[model samples]
Target: MTTTDAVRPTGPGLGAVLSDAELAAVRADFPLLGRTVRGGRPLVYLDSAATSQKPSVVLEAEVDFYEQRNAAVHRGAHQLAEEATEAFEAAREAVAAFVGAGAGEIVWTPGATAAINLVAYAFSNATAGRGGAAAEPFRLVPGDEIVVTAAEHHANLVPWQELCARTGAVLRWFGVTDDGRLDLSNLDEVITERTRVVAFAHVSNVTGAVAPVAELLAAARRVGAYTVLDACQSVPNLPVDLPALGVDFAAFSGHKLLGPTGVGALYGRRELLEAMPPVTTGGSMVEVVTMEATTYAPPPQRFEAGTQMVAQAVGMGVAAQWLGELGMEAVAAHERELAAELVKIAEIPGVRVIGPVDTADRLAVVSFVVDGVHAHDVGQVLDDRGIAVRVGHHCAQPLHRRFGVAATARASASVYTTADEIIAFREALAGVRAFFGVD
Candidate 1:
């Protein structure tokens, strides 16, 4: 696919609920979606919340970057280097626009986990007086509280734990209700004056529950705490506007957004990013350097040190543009239908949904447990029928513990998922207990 072809996918039309024909056409854009698994049974990919499949345009963009114009960005005056830099920066603008952030506020990282680590370590750097006066506000004193939630993936939760360890700050969290919703009835109590940083998932990876962003943000604001959103789930499935949501920082991965792996983004407010100190050092991020000392670059570059994921970033930019053309309203609307269908698995005797059973304020990701049967066994039964799903804690062990379960089998949908596939999943799931002799 050429540059022009990359922008125009033969998928669904913009900003409307996709018809059956439109969904079929959209699924065709993803080559892997058509393939079969486990002895020619048609693939029913329902693990999108774990990672999304890439479309042809995203694949082509990466190939084009390497094949046509591959060079080290922000170096060299030659044509290849200049073009590479342009493509790389253009990708940044595309991603920033997709999430309603400024281009300067978006910094490239290895993944959402690394992006969160960057902020955490940057805060650690500030506590050590790296950025001097400007970094003062970011510094954490002993007994200061850093709040997360009981439903966070390890990527969102562990970094804060490590940061609290490093800075002598206390780690705190909001609990999850029995129905898998965030227990924010005590929001003010959790986000008290001592809270210096408040980080939580925009969507629970295990529960498929959307966090109350407005209320959470307001609570953080009232306490003058920095808000960091782990948008790894929400950004891909829902339309997100970081600026409008007013989070001080947000992180999401490329692979989760129908783009390639090895690239992710950190969205920060312009002023906050500028004030934050660098975590990774050396190479392009530096503005000036001496044998004895070095001064760093601006907000993004200052944080983005060393060689970058140039091709992957380019692919991510194309993906953002492709999804934009498809219209997020349509993508979200389609997934909401899938979410409702997935919930019906609970109707199967001895089967239980671990998350919300209704379609209200959730994505298509659903985790469920089978009575008297292990989650891995349930996954194997589905896999035998050419259905793919995630098994285990889904990286939110605390939430799993809260629910009194060890693990669960998760079926998550994407924009291309079909109602027929959901029917197949439910049929397969209904037989799990029978196969295990637990019916």
Candidate 2:
């Protein structure tokens, strides 16, 4: 177990998905990649699942907004406000287009967690008779069931748990298989007629296993239940079409998609959003407000309370445009090559890959545990060599519990990841057991 005689990976390996020159150019767009870390060691970042490094274009977009047009949107008749409102709305349209959603279907939230909470709280409110007859579809009775998967991130899981708690509904979850995929064998039993909602992650942050969206959606449809998708992991790395996926609601964050951290989007069907009550109440979301009564605006505005994250939204819009120009299919292909190399960690002795060993229908996110070593120690060893990775339960405690692990060291890739970086990671990983005297 050593770095000696290790051969570096080369090319995109996915035939012109990203030419060597184009790949190099794409890497150059990320300014942080140019810096060295840990006493002059070259940085090898592989934690895109936590937060992607911002590209120059995205950074420039945010700076440009603050420098040129910084004003509150939708509340003023002045010139700066008008420009800000237009820019903000334009960013909304761009982000909506990126996911194949209508502009009106998008609601601005602080991040993916908030987006999920918005829907959850709306449901809680509906059960309390908040939206009147319009929200009857969202109401949950004591015996009604809410379905989730064991592989869901905490963002997608906890909110629904809280919702069920508030509404006296039962919370049930689909099991994860030994191979880390959702165990959909009991789909009919799990998503019965008593189920009112089914929520799951589009791609697991820990295992990188792509959920069976079509199968899950079909079951939900058969039972006449609404579907909520946690797209935080998939939207950044894969070609996602929310409209085509036909989920009733979806959520993703900007920071995971090469944009800023303060903004994210929730995509709901227009009619559902219109019917759902706003979770947060404030100035901008209202149509008319009195001392005793208030009427809210439409879907997008109603969910977007108070001032929005204008610059962050603009940066995310630029990020969406940048990814669109590169083409999501090529992005997925490039990452597939990276994942193929990444999964080779399982070939090393005493190291177990936590997900499906194959790259099919998966993104580049990979997690593994080393024998006789804590995940934090493994992460520290890699970090000492300037290899950045995530190490922990990764917000999916149930999935880790299912695998009989407390935590794992994860290496995730983005569009900027190169074959050399993957090689570095592999070589660094090869030395872990030996370094700890476990071999």
Candidate 3:
């Protein structure tokens, strides 16, 4: 079957909400959503930010690849190799189109973390006298600055830190506001002429805040800095067009998009990818090699080394096409409804929201702290009722520090998530303080 053939198509029209019946059908697409947990209390998964559950169509796509076409991609002229390569490349095209990119601009990586690392290390390689004049744009000088936000996940923050450490570049950052949004009010100060790179999230994974991309992009353009977007949170939850956003590079993982975990993609503008040197060197990435030296392949393949993740890419492509069939406007509208319901958690006594208190320009994600109750204790109480939530700093320690808390409990929503599930989660959350005698 083709990538989207097995997917159960549904029509929810533009800006249409997934009604109760539509939601029931959507939930049925994922087998895990129907399973029970915590002594059969019915699993209420609110942790899509951490990772998303796979639908049967995505699962089947992987299995179908391995069972039917299990040869190495872009290698042999055998029939299986041709088919595998076809499926693999088709996936790149699908994911590229999903984000408004061309297939040639997409490079496969293990995950978004690895994708970001690839770009950082490329800069490191360029600064160390690699890639010649073509890589001048990637080079960093001693006084050059790399900027990130305080709200960055460790994945986005740490790689740039290492890049600066390797290249003698300075690291700068934008702070967080009281409401957990990017404090870009002083954008001119944070991103200046010396800023060589500026990295930030499209949406806060912890705060559910949609970033002001247009404002940030304009600033980065003013300074001629390359913009890298940590799009892991936004790609699955919103309709993202990388080119339209005007980011120089963007990264997202397949697992969070309802595909397999072993695969993700990095999208670089075609010209930038050609200029950027490869971080990993091996088999398929070479154009020509000898005992003395080796020449590299073009972009995309230049960064992808060794055997590719063929089956995972195939599944991710299907996931992208699956979402396309549902229409992103509708997907976003459905989540907005869930976001409205989720924000009500802030209304619970003794609970304080860590992010925006309202649903405006945010995802269906809420992180909150309960008065006199540790976030871990709150999570434990909720888990006892078969509700899964992410507790702790959520990989954003600096952001939590900005909020004057060590950690907070975060409940996130996905396509299959329902309003009733949010209600159940809220009811369970309401009793968390009482369970610990902090009510």
Over 4 Å off in model 3, which ranges?
4-6
Residues 1-439 of candidate 2: C-alpha lDDT, one tens digit per residue: 0111111223344334888887888888899999999999999999999999988878877877888888999988999899888878888888899999999999989999999999999999899889879999999999999999999999999999999889899999999998889999988889999999999999999999999999999999999999999999999988899999999999999999998999999999999999998799998899999999999998899998887898999888878877876778888988999999999889988899999999887778999999999999999999999999999999999899999999999999999999889989999999998999999
Backbone clashes in model 1: 0
Give candidate 2 regions above 4 Å deviation: 1-16
User: By TM-score, is 2 or 3 better?
Assistant: 3
**What residue pairs are clashing in model 1?**
none
After the best TM-score superposition of candidate 1, give how far the Cα of residue 25 lies from its true spot, in angstroms.
1.3
Residue 350's lDDT in candidate 2: 88
Kindly give the number of clashing pairs for every candidate: 0, 0, 0
| Model 3 lDDT-worst window of ten | 1-10
What is candidate 3's lDDT per residue for 382-435, written digit by digit as tens?
999999999999999989998899999999999999888999999999998778
* Residue pairs that clash (backbone atoms under 3 angstroms), model 2: none
Q: What's the TM-score of each model vs. the native?
A: 0.98, 0.96, 0.99
Deviation of model 2 at 423, angstroms: 1.1
lDDT of 2 at 301: 93
- lDDT (Cα atoms) of all candidates against the true structure: 0.91, 0.90, 0.91
